[model samples]
Target: MPSHRAAGLVAGLLWLASLWLPAISLAARHADMDLQAFEQNGWWLLTAGWVGIFSGQPAWLANLLVIGLVPTLLMGKQPPWWVSLACAALSLLSLALPGTTIHFDGGPYRVVAFDIGYWLWLLAAQIPALLMLTELNVRRRAK
Candidate 1:
C-alpha cells in the first residue's frame, strides 16, 4: 500500500510537471513549434502516466489533470477511458512520432498531445477504479 501510494503521488507530480513543456508550447500563441517542442514534451506524458500508475494519486486529481491536458489535442474530447487508452497508446507510438516535430502536425500532434495529455488524465482518473480492483483481488486471495 505504501508503494502504491508513492506511485500515485509520482504520477500526479508528473502531470503537474508536464503542463509546462511541449503541451504548453503548443498552447501558447507564439510557440516555437520546433523539434525541441516535441522532444521533452513527448517524454513528459510517458513519465506522468508511469508515475501516476505507481504513485496512486487520487482519482479526482487524475480527472483534473486530464482536463488540463485536453487542450493540447485541439480535437473533440471523449470519455475518460478513451483518453487513458490513448496515453498508453502514445507510449508505444513514440516510435512513430519521433523527435523534432511541432505539436500540431496532425497525426504527430494528436498522437502526442492527446495521447499523453488525455491518457495521463485518464490514468489518474481511474485510480479509484484500480483501487477497487486491487481491493477485490486482495479479498479473493483472503477467501
Candidate 2:
C-alpha cells in the first residue's frame, strides 16, 4: 500500500536517527567513548564518510539500510525462530563494533544493551519496509 519513495524516506530517517542515538546517549552519561580504538582501524573514518554520503541522498541510502538488515534478520541471533535469531546476531555484531555501548557502573567497557536493542528494533522496522517495496516493484513489473 506504500510507495518505494515512502519506504525509502521512512527507512532513511530511522537509519539516520539510529546513528545519532548512540552518540547522544554516551554524551548524556559522560561516558568515555573509545575513540582511539574506533579510529585506529579507520572504521570511524569509513563510517563517517559513509554517513556523509548518506546525508546527500537519504532515501536511497535508507533502501540500502533495509537490504542490509535482511541479512541480520535472517541470521543474526535473537531467538524467535523468525526475526529473533538474526536480531541476536546483529546484537552481537553491534557489540563487536565501535561507538556502541553504555558504561555507568564503574566498568572498563560500556554496556551494549541499548545499542543492540536500538539497532535491532530499528532494523525490524526497516526490513519490512524494504520487503514491501520489493514486492511493490515486482507487482509493477508484472503489470
Taken over the whole model, the C-alpha lDDT of each candidate is 0.41, 0.39
lDDT of 1 by residue, 1-143 (tens): 55345445645565555454343122222345544322335345544434333333222333444444334222332224445554444333333332223334343332234435444443544443354456569889999
Model 2, position 136: C-alpha lDDT score: 62
TM-score of 2: 0.33
Model 2: runs farther than 4 Å from truth? 23-110, 115-117, 128-143
Q: Write the per-residue lDDT of candidate 2 for residues 92-123, one digit (tens) a residue.
A: 34333334432333543332234432553346
Q: In each prediction, how many residue pairs overlap at the backbone (N, C-alpha, C within less than 3 A)?
A: 12, 12
